[model samples]
Target: MAYVAAAAVLLGLLVVTNLILTVGVVRRLREHTAELAALRGGGSGGLDVDVAMPAGTPVGGFDATSVADLPVSLATLGERPLVGFFSPNCQPCKEKLPSFVEYAATRPQGRDAVLAVTIGTREETAALAELLGPVATVVVESDQGPVQRAFGVSGFPAFVLVEEGVVSASGFDLAPVVDRDAVALPAAG
Candidate 1:
C-alpha cells in the first residue's frame, strides 16, 4: 500500500512538471509567432520563406552603395558567382551555413565561387564573415539595404547564381541544390 501511494505521488509530480513544460513551450511559440508577424510587416500573419528574385534578373545594374568598398564589382559578377544572402537573426540561416561551407569547400575557396552577403552591422556579422571568409567573398550591408532590396531578397538564406551579371538560377534553400550538385559530379576512378 505504501509503494502504491509513492507511485501515485511520483505520477502527480510528473504531470505537474509536464504541465509547466507545456505552458513554457506554448509561451515561446506565441512569442515566435509574434516575431514572425512583425518581420512579415503585418502581412496576414504568414512568414515568406521564398526568394523574391526571379531567374534571369539583371544583377549587375543593382546599386550596392550601402555596402561600401565592395570586394567584387557589380560590373563583373565573375564567371559564376553564387551569392548567398543571410541575416544575423535567422536560425535557418545559421543551420544552412554548414551546408553552404561544405558546398564551398568542394570549389576553389575565396573570392571566386561564392559571395556571402549579410544584412547587419560589421560587428554583428564579423564572426559570420570570418566563418565564410576562407570559402567566400563576404559583403556586409544594412537590413533591407539597396543591394538586398534590388536583388528582391525579402528573407535570409537565399541563393542566386550570377553569370555575366544576370541571375541564372535562385532558391530559398541551399540543401537541395547542394545535394543535387554533389551527386551530379562524375566519380573519380
Candidate 2:
C-alpha cells in the first residue's frame, strides 16, 4: 500500500511539471507570433516579406566589371535598367533565372538594359554567368559585393527596376517589375 501511494505522488508531480513546461512553451510561441506580426508591418495582415530595398529608394553608387569585361556602374545603367541580384547557392535564384532571362531577352535596349549580379567566385559562378551572358551583362562578385551594397540587397533573387539611379520598383517577384513593360494589344482582325 505504501509503494502504491509513493508511485501515485511521483506520477502527479510528473504531470504537474509537464503542464508547467507546456504552458511555458505556449506562452513563448504566442510571444513569437506577436513579434512576427509586428515585423509584418504592424499587424497590417499582409504576409509579403520585405526582402529587398523598397521602391523610390535611391540606389547607392557602385562600379563593377562584367564577365564580358565591360564597365557597369550606376551612371552606365542608362535611362532605366532592370537589375537582378542572384546567388549561385540560392535555390530560388536558380528557379527564377529562366524567367529573368526570358524577360531580359524581350527588353527594348537589349542586354545593356539588364544587369545580372551573381554573388560567387569564378569557379562557382561560371555556369550561371555563362547562362546570363546572353541575356544580361553578368557581373560575378563576392558576398556583399559593391553592386549588392549599392542596391541595398538584403536577399537573393531580388529584382530592382532603377530609373535615373533611383529604384522605381523592387521586390522578390518578377511580375511587378515585368509588368512595367506589359501593354495590352488590340484584338487581331
Which number leads on TM-score? 2
Mind giving the per-residue lDDT tens digits that candidate 2 earns over 49-127? 5556788799888899988888989777776888998888887788788999998998877888789999989889998
Identify the candidate with maximal lDDT: 2
Model 1 lDDT per residue over 68-170, tens place:
3654556545556677888888887887888788777675423566777888999998878878877777788888776677678877778776656666666
Candidate lDDT scores, in order, read 0.69, 0.81
- Taking all chains together, each candidate's TM-score versus the true structure is 0.62, 0.77
Error of 2 at 89 (Å): 1.7
Alpha carbon deviation, residue 99, candidate 2 (Å): 0.7
